[model samples]
Target: MVNLVVTLRKKSQGIWRSSFVRSVAVVASGTAGAQAVTIAFAPLITRLYGPEAYGVQGAFISIMSVAAPIGALAYPISVVLPRRDEEALGLLRLSAYISFFIAALIAVGLWLGGEAVISLLEIESISTLIYLLPVAVLFAAWKQMAERWLIRKKAFGVIARSALANSGFLNSARALAGFVYPSGAVLIVLATVAEVLHALLMLIGIRKRTTIDLSESSEVSTSNVIELAHRHRDFPLYRAPQNTINAASKSLPVLMLATFFGPSTAGFYMLSQMVMGMPSTLVGKAVSDVFYPRITEAAHNGENLSRHILRATGSLAAIGIVPFAIVIFFGPWMFSLVFGEEWSMAGEYARWLALFFFFNFINKPSNAAVPVLGIQRGLLFYEILSTGGKVVGFLLGFYWLNSDIWAVAIFSVVGVIAYSGVMLWVYLCAVRWDRDKKAV
Candidate 1:
């Protein structure tokens, strides 16, 4: 027994000593801190703002979520792929330009038919706040661009600090503002401000720490940006559409619940999603952010990626299963205790959502591997199928079952199956890539 204990300790120590583990720890620590702030303030925030406010905010956020990824035409995600800093800088510039254009176009549309859009979506509660959507989308796009650039430079420390700062400022502001006003518009505006602040912090960090020469004339030139855009055109053509569809699918429940049931129901669903997604934000996202560059480097060196994929998947599964199981069993009780009795329904929604999140939790490695494997086109098709499934499931529950819980339950099941299939496909693709590399 003594020998077994000693051996296990040593093995764990060895694993912790690896660079990948260290990187993940750095990012996760920051994310953990950020999530801690959000969690600490959540009970107070919920009580002050109420479900209807969150539902309004959730509806606005759903629109931003769907539009943000495509704002830069998915080019920001390609930042880590290039071998040269200059090329990466060019991609960054290209993403910024595209994001600005898209935001401007959205603003124009809103100016022309903003009221019509509100009536169409049945979201008149946010008629005044809806104009901020383009601004929020632009901020989100820029934040992602900065984050990807930091990732490419392996500036994980900066990334972590920025997350902490963003969360601290955003939550503190929300809590203070809610104490005075507690309006949905307040939440939406603060969220957008948080994005811009986070982006600026990262940009400043890059200027201070990273060795990349931003002043280099060739890197930020229009021609270089154009060249890089053409070279990575697959992002705009395939990856953009894939991301948009995936975001739409994920946000559909909130929108549908709001339109069919009421904003309060959507609010309950939103709160449940927010609470349940904490684990993914704290660990899964950290792992994905760190793992992306590592796997990209491995692919560039023609190294085998199968082992990395399997190991990451297994580790995430082990880390995520216990908390998710706890939620599955005691979700309602926990939510009632922590968030207030008003949010008990949110807990009910969380129990079913836990099943889907567990799969999503373990699928981060596979999500990171898609771009590395150059399988965006195939993934696009899969997303379409996944989205279609979600729509069918949601509509069935809404029209036939006539229960909000039923709609959420069906949506969760479809998500679980879709993410499971994605994990399998990505793992097989990694295996084939390894085999082909060996043959060469």
Candidate 2:
């Protein structure tokens, strides 16, 4: 009996190790490909679009950000932990339908609320918001859901290739539009169209890979969705609050900058975010793409889930933090040189935000592990406190002192650190609980 147990343990360990390798290979390749396409286009986008265009894009990005969770309606979380083929397809269809409906509503809302959105962003015109519907928000949501679905299916190659193709199309369209239209307004419109084109391509790629047959199976009903929601009830229950806090915390400062500092200063800040976000988002997202699915698979046994989570946290931290430090030191000058002299101030903003991004990079993957381990309530509590802290910081910076740009910068750095600290504590506590439970 002892000999048999030893052999079984060895086999289990080997299987886990293999799964780790496969997960890393797939996620890394996809993330690296995405980073490549986005990074390669950075110079051209900056040169052609300019800072004001970037500021507008950033504002639009904030509004469109709501589209993802709204359209997905918790489907990303569902995809990460589907227990059966039927469950996976059900969630997939529900997510698509939810996304389409929400996108249409949002597009129409944007059309009606164009003036309000433009005024809120402090831009001079609503023209950009008017066209933001079909080209930008809807397509952007489609692309995100498609990407999440691809991750669920473990189709990394499809993701990589589509990212490249999408980037190529977007840049090419922007270039042509700039040459012919000359107005920034037209270029923004064209970019939205490009995003739709990108989504269409990803959809084609997804269809080829997954065997999702809705016709043969019984239709997923309202009760089915509600049941699915109840099945993974912890997702939006825990994730939604955390996501809302994090999203609001991140966006609030940018919104304040736009409100007080004007679009040009906001433009500079936007550039900084775009630069620092690449690494943070890339590493965190890649690890998450693997971590959620794997941890979910292992969750029935606490010991297995804990080991996987810790292993992932370590790998993600090591890879994510080192480059973050290097970027912090060299980031300002790199920004100036890369983005041109007009964007020199962006370098200053970059330096501060880099620290925030680094902390975020270090902590985000670990936070992602919580939901998979069934400890999302802890994360929710942390985000609640962190969001309160962020709001206080924002008020102190913007309202009390009336320091515009610097206030925004300081708030970002401090808010991220505070948020990361809480997240770390929660993750560690969850890890300890798993260990103790395993001992029992």
Candidate 3:
């Protein structure tokens, strides 16, 4: 019995030490630490800023999220696929230039019609801070580019440390600012600063470790960059639209709740999302970040991917279900306990959102697999359909049921359905690809 126990222990250790598991651990640990900081500071921050301020910040973040994904036309996302460091470097530079141009375009648009757009969204509270959106977008785009390059280098440790540092700085600044001036404007400004800091940290981290001699490399010339852009046009044409629509779908509730119900309501929703999203952010994103390069490599090598996809999905489901269940059952009480009574409503929102987030959590593998499957065009249409469903569900609750909880509940249900469909479709696609590859 003693020998058997020892053997089993060794086996478990070996499994844990596997590359995939180790990579996940590195990224997840950093993310977990970051989330811990955010969680630790939440009570104090919420008390200082209150819901209305959070609502204003949430609205600004929503708009930023919708625009930031496409700021570089999704070129950074393709950075991991290139075989050569020079080519990847070229792609990186191209993405940066495009991001700058997009940022300038955003600035121009804001200069021309910023107030009207703010009025239309009913987010005039953030009117003064809205002009900073372009700068924030640029920072967000740069951060993504830097992170993607780190991912390509398999520098998961650096990526993880940067995430921890970014979260630490952002949350600390927010808490500190709240004590001095707990306005939405302050929150927005600090949030933008956090983006800039994160980008710089990631870039600096890579610069120290990377052996690529960009100064000597003439391969990243104008013509070469254009050629790389053309080669990866599918990202801009398909993935960009897909990502934008997907972001809009997720962010729509924040905007709609603010516009229809009130900013305070949106604030509640935002808090719920932030809290409920912890599991996904901690594990799902780590898994996706590590899994993407592996899946891409497997695809290039004609290896089977369905097994990987299924295994990751199953593992995430097993890990997530219990915590999500806890939220579903005791979310309101937990929120009230942690954030005080004013946040109990946010807990109510979290109860329903837990279901959506569970499916979203399990779908990370599929999300990572979609781009690898060369199905970006199809995915774009699917995103549109999914967004439409979310809109219809939200409107149905608002116009027919006339209850905020019902609206959130319906929106979450639609999200659950949409993400489930994506997982199923991606799994089937992987199976077909594997079968065809074997036949060939």
lDDT of candidate 2 vs native? 0.68
- The residue pairs in collision within model 2 are none
Better of 1 and 2 by lDDT: 1
Candidate RMSDs in Å, in order, are 1.2, 5.3, 1.3
For each candidate, what is the lDDT? 0.92, 0.68, 0.92
> Candidate 2 residues 352-428, lDDT tens each?
77778877766655676666656678777877777777677767877788876567566766767785676567567
Q: How close to the true structure is residue 26 of candidate 2, measured as C-alpha lDDT? A: 63
Q: Where does candidate 2 stray beyond 4 Å?
A: 1-18, 126-128, 181-187, 216-222, 436-440
Local accuracy of candidate 3 as per-residue lDDT tens digits, 304-420: 899999999999999999999999999999999999899999999999999999999999999999889999998998999999999999999999999899999999999999998
- Candidate 1 per-residue C-alpha lDDT over 1-440 given as tens digits, one digit per residue, 9 for 90 to 100: 99999999999999999999999999999999999999999999999999999998998899889998899999999999989787888888888889999999999989999998688667786698898889889988988998999999899999999999999999999999998999888998898888789889998998998887868735467876788899899999999999999999989999999889988999999999998898899999999999999999999899889899999999999999999999999999999999999999999999999998899889899999999999999999999999999999999999999999999999999999999999999999999999999999
Task: Tell me the TM-score of each prediction against the true structure.
Answer: 0.98, 0.85, 0.98
TM-score of 2: 0.85
Candidate 3 residue spans exceeding 4 A from truth: 1-7
The Cα error of candidate 1 at residue 284, in Å, is 0.7
